[model samples]
Target: MAQITLVAAACVLVLSHSFLPGVKGTTFTIVNKCDYVVWPGILSNAGVPTLPTTGFTLQRGETKTINAPTSWGGRFWGRTHCSQDSAGKFSCLTGDCGSGKLECSGNGAAPPATLAEFTLDGAGGLDFFDVSLVDGYNVPMLVVPNGGTGQNCTYTGCVGDLNDSCPSELKVMNTDGGTGGVACKSACEAFRQPQYCCSGAYGTPDTCKPSSYSEVFKRACPRAYSYAYDDKTSTFTCAKADYTITFCPSPNTSQKSSQGQDTETTAATTSPLDFNSTMVYEGAFEESGASPSILAHVFRSHAIVGIVGITMAVRWIF
Candidate 1:
């Protein structure tokens, strides 16, 4: 009796060990922390090629998570643009300038070029890490890593102006023989004409007053903002603001998958193992636990017998 019991226990142990799933990969959660919106992309270590599903919208203060295969060994980073629309929503406008046309001059219809690409090293997994969204004006906003975070892009100034152009231009309501037919010729003229003013102060004969619209326009556009990123200085400068893009090293064991979702675990990581060091184990049950151990063994022992039994069972059940 003792021998029989021992044999059965040993069989169960072997079955459990053989049937356990294995860890297949690691995952990462990217957080948006910049002031503007972001469109994230995964890149290789050489930065030569992009990985699958390279594009995703990340509004300011939002987060997203992705999974990578255990076989992948390349670095991962993100590229951001101001024009990325939220999911299920269409972009009112496209290109780097956000919603408005690139240029306000001459029909004003050229898209702006992408401002910059932010890169980060890809590891086996990451927790809720912060990724920033920066605007053309070089403003920094926040985003959480993965879908666990909420959308809360901060608008320090006015919104809905599109174009993302600061010192926003005042809309001219009426061009009734103003200095320029459609737009203002100079700052002085914009204020002098009431029809062009957004305040609607100049349009009516009774209120024909020269408003300060020109001054406001100058305050918004102001010589076209310039951005300077000095690698040597390790700093980014725009207008009157400066920031540093720094990395925070984390322990290898501190990493965790985003939201504990199985689907997301496979998106951010690489595919089909490559470099040895780059590979990571997700767990032990991921690969081996597809069916019951007894069924698997029975099928393995006699393929014909199992096939016949399975066919009969399926027929009867259906």
Candidate 2:
């Protein structure tokens, strides 16, 4: 009877492990398709265990992979035009984590930076994610699910280079005093108005409506978060999947749009690729063509067998 009890207990334990999503946790594959080098910064949410490395450098055409445990919540952004000073302090023009080192430690990206946010293993065991312009726009970014399923698991991002056409009032000029802009500041960051910032009496979603500035972003990246209240169009979810984050995803895409010399016209026609209104992820100019893995089918097959084993174990215990 003692030996039977031990066998039954072990069987149940082994079978239960199969129920967890991302059995080995999720893998975040960061790829750099931008022409210049990018120093990627990562910040885990408060109370969550930090990832192995908070920040790292990715040269043009380079790639890095990081594994995040189940239930991990955090945000990622690329630091552009980075330099290390004589004192060995590292910083960047855009998306700087303000840690003064390659590792962000625990600091979040500063405003006027593009961000990709994630909450893994949330309600219903789904992974929630979004590319947000609420802080502002610096670099073009895209988020693609590797092997995930859910109606909302499709691609989401602001792939347009908005800096070149950023409104003069909201433009963050290149420190080099070049004619071009490097980052586009959010209206909230630029004016600090209660309406733009969605603060004070305007804190509620009802009161805080989309301003004209946010509309510019919405027109460029329809699927991304344009403002504090853009949740309905921006947020996405998936279960049991890896992810690929690409900066400047399209090879043909340049920092400046190819739509002649008119900045306003270029801004309106951000990308040559047609955005599918359906939000179904179609192959892009440079998509990796990742499809949902057969693991889901394998999981279903094993699940049935595991359930039978668990039932037998319970009968034996009884």
Candidate topping lDDT: 2
lDDT of 2 by residue, 1-318 (tens): 886878777777766666665365677888888888989999999988788789999998898777776699999998988999999999998999888999999999998999999999999999999999999999888898877899888878887778877889999988955557889999999999999999999999999999999998888889899999999989999998788888877542334346555544543554522455223122322323322343454456567877788787768667
lDDT of 1 at 92: 22
- The lDDT of model 1 is 0.29
Per-residue CA lDDT of candidate 1, range 17-107, in tens?
4435542223344445434464543433342323334445666556554443323333223232323234533232222222232121112
* Model 2 residue 152 distance off true place after TM-score fit, in angstroms: 1.5
In terms of TM-score, the best-performing candidate is 2
Give the Å error, residue 220, model 2.
0.7
- What are the C-alpha RMSDs, in order, of all predicted structures? 23.0, 7.0
Write down the lDDT of every candidate, Cα atoms only. Answer: 0.29, 0.81
Model 2 has an lDDT value of: 0.81
Name the weakest run of 10 consecutive residues (lDDT summed) in model 1.
153-162
